[model samples]
Target chain A: MTAALEFREIDVSFGGTFALHKVSVGVHEGGWLGVVGPNGAGKSTLLRTVAGAVRYGGSVLVDGEAIDGRSQRERARLVSYVPQRPVYPQGMAVFDYVLLGRTPYLGTLASESHEDIEDVWEALEALRLTDFAGRDVATLSGGETQRVSLARVLAQRAPIVVLDEATASLDVAAQHSVLELIDRLRAERGMTVISAIHDLTAAAQFCERIALIDDGRVVAEGTPGEVLTESLLGEVFEPSIRVIDVDGSTVIVSLRVEEDPS
Target chain B: MNAGRPSSTRLRWWWVGGAALVLAGSLVAGVMVGPIRIPPIEILGTLINKAPFVTIDTAISDRTEAILWEIRMPRVVLAVLVGSMLSAAGAGYQGVFRNPLADPYLLGAGAGAGLGATIAIAYGPATSGWFIDPLPLAAFVGAIGGVALAYLLGYTVRSGRTAVTLILAGVAVAAFLTAIQTFLQQRQSETLREVYGWILGSLNTAGWEEVELVAPYVLVCLFAIFIGRRLLDVLAVGDTEAGTLGVRPGRIRLVIVVFATLGTAAVVSVSGLIGFVGIIVPHTVRLLTSSSYRVVVPLSILLGGAFLVLADIVARVAMTPAEIPIGVVTAMIGAPFFAVILRTSKAVVS
Candidate 1:
């Protein structure tokens, strides 16, 4: 079978500046690929290019076919995307907002049916958000709101899910819970995930393979043991970091640099 | 999106029913409570008599018949049509632009129509009859012209048709057109009175021809808008979200803007730039119902018509003999009510 997702020489620019270089990556069916990069390193841009949220050069294909060739409905059914920072449609209640994921199934003139409505509730329940269904989206706490965003993507029921910094804003415990939940969901449902994460340790712990990006280029890509080495991360990140194994879980420890007077 | 979860489907139906009842009451009062007194039953009998098979012995007189058919009936119909068109278009504009403050008059249609009317009053024959209603015709052409200009300028300057750019372009175009209209008003004394009166807005000269001018466009636009209501909800989240939802936000915005502009131009061409109805009616509908366009669009039509008709009645009776402008009444009432709604409703602010 073909790889579930592929990016071959994807290049994206805004105005005159490049957001991503000629980047290429792919994930196997039902596999998780974590993307880690410093700020402005084009990690989010790579995911956005695959999501078709940004104009890009070259091909980003799903299941061996170019995505741009597909209709909006087809692409929506094939892949779901969650932006890092979502501006929730103000005044929309959580239930109704999540229910928008059923757009692919709905005819232009028709509202949601019983099945679609049931699926929205199911998504809300899965996210532990059933209680907040009637709440205005603007009033949600950061974690709850992020879960709601994830719930919307969940309701899409797509095979491939891409999240850009899905847990960046959560507390440490909340982040672990969200990562754990995503892992459990993927294991149970056989979902293929490509997440752009800011946390190197979490990416090392959760993802089977990690791609480290720098300045719009994929600088290092392999298993965490191979890619998350001190020398590679030290050069790319401002803070020197060490990656070590503790109880079979990967941990990244930051080292302070001596101050130098200019 | 889920029925009754947010919308309370059954209660929503009750809301619709309630609005229809209000509209019926308004229509009845609109006809019966005019300058000449007529009973409600006789008015109903006169309306029913138009049908081939149905005839009632409500003892309708020729004077009452003429008053109902010739005078009140046409004006009320025009009021409903104009009200429904403006309010529906307003809801559509708000959804497409994803802004609560958006109005039907946002795209320079008000200014364009006013300038068009001003020119006709100053230069065209002032005593023109319904057959050659030069003022409304000129207003229609001018409104279309203004919107077209704004769209072109917005498209060019913004580099893409961003909502903010379009609104900015509209503001600039409207201001420029308003300046020209003011200059023309100052140049001619006769033009001053006509332009000032038209600016205030009135239904004093409403007739079948005005109704005919507005009905076809409103019906078509309203049908088109209602069919595409779900797109509005999708678009509310912005273009990227809309695209992921299997919608082309750009195409949807263009379709909605065109349909709404056509309906708005049609009505404002005849109604002489009636203010506040478009903003207040749709705002009120969203305040009462869920913001889903499926509910808001239809309800706006009913409630907007009823609201405007009631306002017009106030305009008629508030200072009788010398009529208060319908636009003044709508603003005086709508502004305060809308302010109260805005201050109290946190949802609207969001």
Candidate 2:
């Protein structure tokens, strides 16, 4: 079967600066790909480009169909996106906010049906947020809000999901929970995930394949072991790091340098 | 089925009841305490007896009937309609921008209307029969023109068309128009006081004719906004997200802006720029209810109507023989409440 999403020679520019240049990537059905890069490395821009949020040169295909001419709603129905930080309007109940994912299903003047309500409940339950259904979204913690954002995409029921630094604001436990939730969704629903993650270890732990990006180009793409080498980390991340093999698995650790006062 | 959880239906009904009570109270209070001081019982009697033009054996004079039906009733109705339009427009603006601080006048509509009215008055009331009509046709035309200009600027110069940029452009446009209006008012001293008083807003001279003039536009705009309320909710989730849901945010925003500006211009021309009902009423409704435009839009209509009626009552009875401007009453009530809401709630503006 063809990959769920394919980006071929995509180039994206913002004002005078090129954010992404001639980047080619593919995500297979039920695959989990992790993108890791430093700040201003065009990580978010790449994902946004694939999602058709920004105007870009070149082509993106979902299920072997070109998506360049597709409307936002049509693209949305194919691929759901969970932004880095979700901002909720005040006094918006968590349930109502999540139910907004059903916008594509609603008629112009009509309200949500009972099925929509059930879907909202199921989404909240999947995220273990049933207790927060009536609570205001503004009262949620960073982790809870992140999970809620995920729930919104889950309710969209799209086959592909793009998570843009989705767990960056969460605590370690919450981050693990969020990743596990994504894994569960992928396994149960046969969905594909493309997460732009910052934590290299987390990326290695969760992603089936790792794509290392630098200055808008993909430097390496392979299994975590093949791509996350000591030299590669040093070159791409500009950090002193050691790669060790522990129990048939490679682990990367950064070494902090001591400051010299001369 | 969660225990003690209020179903959306029940909560909506509760809001409906609360809105109905407020409307009834405001209407009774509106007809009772004008300069004529008709008792609540007498007003009710007049309303019921006027079905087939019943001749009441009470001491209610012809001036009293004229005041109640011809003057106060239409004024109150106009206030309700204008209030509803402003609040609905404010809610629409807030939804479109995804910002709590957005008001109906964010598109330079008020200033443009003001400039239009100023220019018309400067040219003198005897300029044309169209000008002599109490509707402020020039102001309405200017408001629509201002929005059209803003849209043109947004389309031509801006690349991505951010909501923040639109709001900034609107503010700049308002300031520019207001400056021109002020200069023109300065040149024409005879109409300056009338123009100034109108800008501050009043409901003193409203009658059935003014109500008839503004009602159709308000109804049409309200219908359009109501139909598009769900679309507005989609918009609140950011433009890209809205697009993913198959909505063209740019096109939807244009439609909303045009319809909302029409409603706002129609009302503002008649009411002379009554403030805060647009900004405060919808916001207060949102605070009590949820941010879903489904609930906010309709509730805004009802609460907005009641709010203005109550404010008009206060404007009329506060000083009795000498009436304060309706805008003054709204500002006095709205500004302090707005401060309180901002201080107490964690609602982010953008």
Tens-digit lDDT string for candidate 2 (B110-207): 88999998987787457455435633888898888777777667666646687777877787788888899999999998998889888888888888
- Which 10-residue span in candidate 2 chain B carries the lowest summed lDDT? B2-11
Note the Cα lDDT for every prediction shown.
0.84, 0.82
Residue A93, model 2: lDDT of 73
| CAPRI class assigned to model 1 | medium
Clashing pairs in 2: A72-B243, A72-B244, A73-B243, A73-B244, A73-B245, A73-B246
- Which regions of candidate 1 deviate over 4 angstroms? A260-262, B1-11, B126-131, B342-347
Q: Would you give me the overall lDDT of model 2?
A: 0.82
User: Number of clashing pairs, model 1?
Assistant: 0
Instruction: Compare the candidates by lDDT and give the number of the best one.
Output: 1
Question: CA lDDT of A7 in candidate 1?
Answer: 88
Candidate 2: stretches off by over 4 Å: A258-262, B1-11, B39-42, B45-63, B125-135, B336-350
Clashing pairs in 1: none
